[model samples]
Target: MTAMEANTDEGVIDAHHHVWDLSVRDQEWITGPEVAPLRRDFLLADLKPEARASGVTATVLVQTIDIPEETPEFLAVAADSDLVAGVVGWTDLTSPDVTRALAALRERPGGEYLVGIRHQVQGESDPRWLVRPDVLRGLAAVAEAGLVYDLVVRPHQLAAAHEAARLLPRLTFVLDHAGKPPIASGELRPWADAVRLLASLPNTVCKLSGMVTEADRDRWSVEDLRPYADTVLDAFGPRRLMFGSDWPVCRLAATYAEVIDAARELTAALQPAERREVFTRTALRTYGMTFTGSQAPQEAPCA
Candidate 1:
């Protein structure tokens, strides 16, 4: 059966998405014409209505840059917003003072909303950057702080991500965008194999996101993303797979609603309970999130 059609009545936890202000800091990564649509600010006010209309009851605000200040700013945003449930901020993972930095972030006004940490591993030239001694030590610190580590790496970096998960068995490593498969090329050999390898590790999870931009953006459809989506579903299953809009960035290819619709279409075959796990349970468990009042109609017990 196809997944239930997108509806606002269903409680959803958008496991991935971002909000940024150009006035605060140059997204330096937002350069070039292809991403020109995202050149402006994407504050909570802009996303709140779009996400709410799309059935997103809670969301994880992911970090866009490797800056130390960005996380605190995101925590503040989460603290103030009703839609944002968690913040996955970035910090210097290779620094000896990583623990101190994390503690300082936790003490901030909205620090309780900080759920995880992420770095742009995809931009790092070193394939084994995740296993580097310094990075591993910092990852241990992240685990100690009870925070999940988000891996934003390319296909080539999946092996290192697997090894990093192996090395730090305690750290929950979330593979962003399914390690960014080569959907546009429609080649799944290594990407599929690597995703399965990482999914084999019990400590890891994968996000069903960013496929539109990774495919033939101008002409992509749910069919173009099915194979990669199927790979993660078969490997991680719905319980470990979660939905992420990869918004603003996804705006480069499709609108926020389109992304959500495509994801629903991709997971159409799953049972209602399984789909719920992907849309809500998995994120809440992976991020250790809880909802209050009517944010989510039925709250799943926190992990």
Candidate 2:
């Protein structure tokens, strides 16, 4: 629809991205004057065009604003949209009725679309934000519900994420944005250390999404993101890693094709099978999607 092609080169699965509409939903967090670019509504129909251009057959719709009312709303949206294969909705994990909340969210028509839970842990000031007893209990509930936990943390909070990985060995955790490392500053040591530590846990996975936005917004090269991307691959290997476009957020840093190109170039040295997992298979497994649908796979030109 937008003249963009869905990147089919590597069997890609966009592990993370957000879909919101101010009219039907409350995305107040993005209403601030400074965040205007993200204020408008972005529903599934709005996304399908770009998603198709990017060769994204399936996607996991993550929550934008933390609202209990929004989780079920998203599940309803997912129920109607074929492209949105999974949802990583929000829940009051800290609430005493956390399990009940999850149950209610799962019982909706599109409740089957919910594959994971995520809290905006990066917004917290506490370095050890995820280790509190209440939070740990919530994570355990997520595990018990058979859902994955997505860790959206900043670099300082990654140490806490690593700690959470060690503490909750049964919970499946995915590190969003490669820990949101400082690619703009070109700093990698501390983030690399934390990512490696988290990956050492068998249940943890890393997402190769959102790095472009972490680099200089107006000016950045694929080379600038290479070290961080390479490090994530080395730490998690292909099976424990997945691809994501971060979409409209990525629009601030690069086009969908540009970001996809960068990732393909970064992982070019890997065998086809490894690239396949990072691009598609792992996401299918993690988000519980069946890739046996009738849509034929499209091929992409090499960058």
Steric clash pairs (candidate 1): 2-268, 3-268
What lDDT tens digits, residue by residue, belong to model 2 across residues 1-303? 000122233366677878777677666566564457776766678777776776677778888767788888778877777666788999987899999989988887778888999998988888887999999999999999999999999878887888888888888899888999999998888888888888888989989999998998888998999999999999999988898888767777787778878888888888777877888777766766655535634433345
Pick by TM-score: which candidate is best?
A: 1
C-alpha RMSD between model 1 and the true structure: 5.2
Off-target runs (Cα >4 Å) in candidate 1 are: 1-9, 293-303
Q: After superposition, how far is residue 243 of candidate 2 from its true place, in Å?
A: 0.5
Separately for all candidates shown, the number of backbone clashes (residues 3 or more apart, or on different chains) is 2, 10
Model 2, residue 138: displacement in angstroms? 0.7
> RMSD, each candidate, Å?
5.2, 3.9
lDDT of each: 0.86, 0.80
Q: What is the TM-score of each predicted model, taking all chains together?
A: 0.94, 0.91
lDDT of 1 at 258: 89
